[model samples]
Target: MYKKIRFLTILIFALIITAVLSTGFIYSISITNAPSKNSTSIVKDKGSENKAVNTKIKKLDSNSYNILVMGDSLARGTGDESNRGFANDFSSLWRAKAKKPIKVINIAVNGDVSSGLLNIVKDQQNLQYIQDSNMIFISIGGNEIKNFRSTDASSSVVQPNNEKAVQNSYLKNLENIFKLIRSKNQNSIVAFIGLYNPFGDDLTADKLELLNEWNYKTEDLVSSYDNAVYIPTYDLFKYNSQNYLAADNFHPNSAGYEAISKRIFESLKNFKN
Candidate 1:
C-alpha cells in the first residue's frame, strides 16, 4: 500500500513538473508521500514482531486447573495439522499463567451431533470424567443439524431447517445438557462456542440467508439457558474467510480458534457464580 502511494506521488510530481516546464507556469505542486525506503522497512519490522510472538509461544506453561473440553471438531482441533486446536493451545497458555497443573480432558469426536452427545450422556463412564471438573468448554450442534448415519445418508441428510420444531429441539437438548451438568456439578461453568456461517463464497444467496437465520436462532437458544454462555465464532470467519478456516473451509484454522478462545476468555468473568 505504501509503495503504491509513493508511486502515485512520484507520478503526480512528474506531471506537475512537466506542466510547469512546458506551459511556463509559475504554479508548482509538491506532493507529500510516505517515504519509499520506509515501506519495505515497515514490512520487515512486522515480520520481526510476528517472529517474536511465535518464539514466545514455545515456552512451557506452569498454571493449573481442571478443564474439560467437549463438543465437536473445533474442540478436537480438526483443521490444525499440529493438532493444537484452541482448547489444547489455550489450556497450555492458561497453565503458563498459573502455578499448578491444568487437567484437560477433550472427549470431542468429529461429526458428533446432538444425538451423539445424548448417547455419551447415557454412558455413565464418560460423564464421570468431568464429574469433578472446574470448567467445561463445548462446541456442539453443527452435527446435530447434520445427520450421516443412514444408508441413504447423502440423499437423506436433512439438516435443520431453522423452523420452530428444529430450533426447539436444539434448544431443549441444550438445556438438557446444562441440566445434566448441573446435576453432576452444580457450579461447573460451561461455555458454548456459537456456530458461524460455514459456507464458502460458494454458498448460494439463499443458503447464506438461511445460515444467518439459523445462526441467530442458535445464539438466542444458547443465551436462553442459565450457566451457559454462547460465544459467537461466526463473524470472526464470515468475512475474512481465508485466514479463519481450514482447507475444508468448514472448520476453523489456528487463528480462528485463537480468536474464539480469546473471546470466551474475555467473557470468563461472567462464568463466575
Candidate 2:
C-alpha cells in the first residue's frame, strides 16, 4: 500500500509539471502573435508623413504662378544697380499685388537678338519651361537695331530702305518666335516689351520715324495673336530719358525698371480681366 501511494504521488507530480509547461507554451504564442505599440506608432507616423507631403504638393500646384522671361539685355536687367531687371521687378510687383507665390525663370542672355531668342525657345529645357509657364515676357529687337546701325555706318544714320529690310527680317523672326512659343503653350499670355529710344533728342527725325514705324508694325503684328500684346516703352523713355536711362545711356536704370514693371503689372491685370 505504501509503494502504491508513492507511485501515485510521482504520477501526480509529473501531470502538474506537464500542465505548467503547456500553459507556458500557450502564453509564449500569444505574446508572439500580438502587435507591438511601437510598431503601430511607426506605421501611423509614416502614413501621416506621406499625407503631409501630398498636401503640400497639391497646394503648390494649385496656387503657384510661373513666369518665363526671354531675350536681350533689358530682360537680363543689365544696367540696374540692384540687378533686379524688369523681369524680377515685375515678378515682385505681381507677387505683392496677387499675394501669391511667383517663380520666375529668366533665360534671357545679354545681347541676344530675336533669332537667338528663337533658338533658345527651341531648346528642350526652355520648351519645357514654356510649357509650364503661366506668362512669358520677351524683350528683343533692340540688339538687331544696334547691329544694323553698326553695320550700316556708311550713312551715319539708318536709311529708310535698309531700315525696312531690317524691320521685315525682325518681324519674320518675331512671328516665328511666337509660333514656337504658342506651339508649346497656348494658354500663356505673351507680352513683348517694345523698344525705347535711348538716344532721345540726339537721334535724327528720320531715324526716329523708322523706329516709330518699327514699333507700329510690331504692335500690329502682336495684335494678330489673340494671347499676345505689345507693351510700348518708347513714350516712357523718350521724354524721360535723362531720369530713366542708366549711366551707360543705353539700358534702363532702377527707376526705369520699376516703371516697366508697373506698366507690365497693369497690362497683366487687364489681360487677366
Top candidate on TM-score is: 2
TM-score of 1: 0.65
After aligning candidate 1 to the native by TM-score, how far in Å is the CA of 265 from where it should be?
A: 1.4
Local lDDT at 193 for model 1: 80
* CA RMSD (A), model 2: 10.0
Candidate 2, 1-273: lDDT as tens digits: 999999999999999999999999999999998888676332235547654444331111336688889999999898899999898888887776556688777899998887888898888778878888888999998987754433345774366576777788889999998888889889888999999989766676666777788889999998898788889998899778889989999999999999998888888776661
TM-scores for all predictions:
0.65, 0.73
10 residues in a row with least lDDT, candidate 1: 55-64
lDDT of 1: 0.67
> Which residue runs does candidate 1 get wrong by more than 4 Å?
1-64, 96-99, 144-165, 269-273
Q: In candidate 1, how many Å is residue 70 off?
A: 1.5
